[model samples]
Target: MIRTATPADVPVIHTLIRELAAYEKASEEARADEKQLREALFGERPAAFAHLAVDDESGEPVGFALWFLNFSTWRGVHGIYLEDLYVRPEARGGGHGRALLTELARICVERGYERLEWSVLNWNRPAIGFYESLGARPQDEWTVYRLTDGALAALGSGR
Candidate 1:
């Protein structure tokens, strides 16, 4: 079962985030604590949204999808930008990941959004294959770039 995340699920979400970080071989980058996550997800004005995929038998959250809305100037509609989608290793192959993605797609269709999009690591063959199987074609013409940490701060300083 998939449901929208509530404040009570912050800890589980945080733990799952760490687990996903470890799986991606970037454990050190998973720095946000539950408090930060709670504020981000359930704050007075939320910056993002999350959904949880729960185990049918145990009724425990096994996976999650974190996303936020993005406005496309060309489409003139808000689309969901999925930031992360993960399922515990032990809980994978049970359709939890697909369920989470399906829920996101459903939200887009119901709201008349033009797209539901996410990025996958180029080296992750399994994930690439899975996305391809779902008819998610890669936007090879565009390159993703970001300035974070010092570069971000420096640029924002208007120097």
Candidate 2:
């Protein structure tokens, strides 16, 4: 069963995030804590949104999709940029990932948005295949870039 996440789901969401980092072989990079998630998701001004996939019987969370909105100047519309999507390893084949993505796509269509996008690591063939099966095509012409840590700090501080 898929449902919108509540503030009560923050702990489980944080755990899932760490689990996802570990699965991606970069556990050390998962630095977010429950407090940050609470503020970001449910604070006075929310910055992001999440949806949870729960066990139909137990109502325990199995997966989640965390996303935020980005405006495309060319399209003159807002689109969802999914930051993370994960289903517990034990629940992998049960269609939770697809459900999560489907919900996001539904949101895009309902809101008249032009895109729902996310990135998958180049080495994750299984995820790539799953996305392809869902009719999502890669933007191969584009290369992603990031400025983080020292580079981000230097640029922000004009050092």
Candidate 3:
């Protein structure tokens, strides 16, 4: 029971995001606002999309995957970059995570995308093993960098 998420699901999605952060031991960092989520997903131009997985019997959402498209200039093709994927603790081992990823892979293949990629915390051994078992290899040679907080503002101001 997996389906694309609608704007109505924003609250549930936000709750799940908090849950994910808590699971990752970064609950304080989960500061997503529901209104902003709605605007992002259902605005004039959406920035991202989400898919929800629900319980077969109860019809209650059990997990979600948020993703967006990315362009690979070298490959001259588009790719899917998964931003977040999370399943409830009680729903662990139920195949929801794999199903979500499988759907994303299908989307990539069907659309002729070059890749489906996401990042995982190095300390999450279980998640790393799960992704490896799915034939996802880490891009160990590439280093990730970010510009945020004061640095991002300073750059924006050309200071």
Candidate 4:
């Protein structure tokens, strides 16, 4: 059962986010707070959106897909840039990941999005292969850039 997430979904979503970080061996990056999530998702103007996957019979959350809208200058269309996608280890290979991806893609198409994009850590070969199996190709000519901490400081240096 895939459905748009609401304020009530935050606690488990937060836990899932942490689980994903830990799976990637990036637990240090999990800094989300409940108050922030609530305001962001249900505020007067939302900053992001999320979808949750739950067990149809048990009613327990199994996974999530969080994303934000992005504008593609070249395509002259909006794109959906997925921020996170995760399914519990016990649930992997059982079709939850594919179901979530499929639903996200369907919603993207329904919204007339020009692209659906995301990235996986280079060391995660299984995920990479899974994405390739789904027919997604790497943007070889383009390199991902981020402006964090020192990088942001350097940008301010005007060098």
* Among all candidates shown, the one with the greatest TM-score: 2
TM-score of each: 0.97, 0.98, 0.97, 0.92
Candidate 4, superposed: residue stretches over 4 Å from native: 153-159
Candidate 1: pairs in clash: none
What RMSD does model 4 have? 1.7
Model 2, residue 47: distance off in Å is 0.8
Report the CA-based lDDT of candidate 1 relative to the real structure: 0.94
- Sequence-dependent TM-score of model 1: 0.97
Clashes of 4: 0
Clash-forming residue pairs, model 3: none
Give me the runs in candidate 2 sitting further than 4 Å from their true place.
none
lDDT of the structure predicted as candidate 3 = 0.94
Superposed by TM-score, candidate 1 places the C-alpha of residue 106 at a distance from the truth, in angstroms, of 0.6
Model 1 worst lDDT window (10 residues): 121-130
Against the unseen true structure, what C-alpha lDDT does each candidate score? 0.94, 0.96, 0.94, 0.88
What would the per-residue lDDT of candidate 3 be over residues 34-137, giving only the tens digit for each residue? 98899888999999999999989899999999999999999999999999999998997999999999999999999999899999999999899999999999
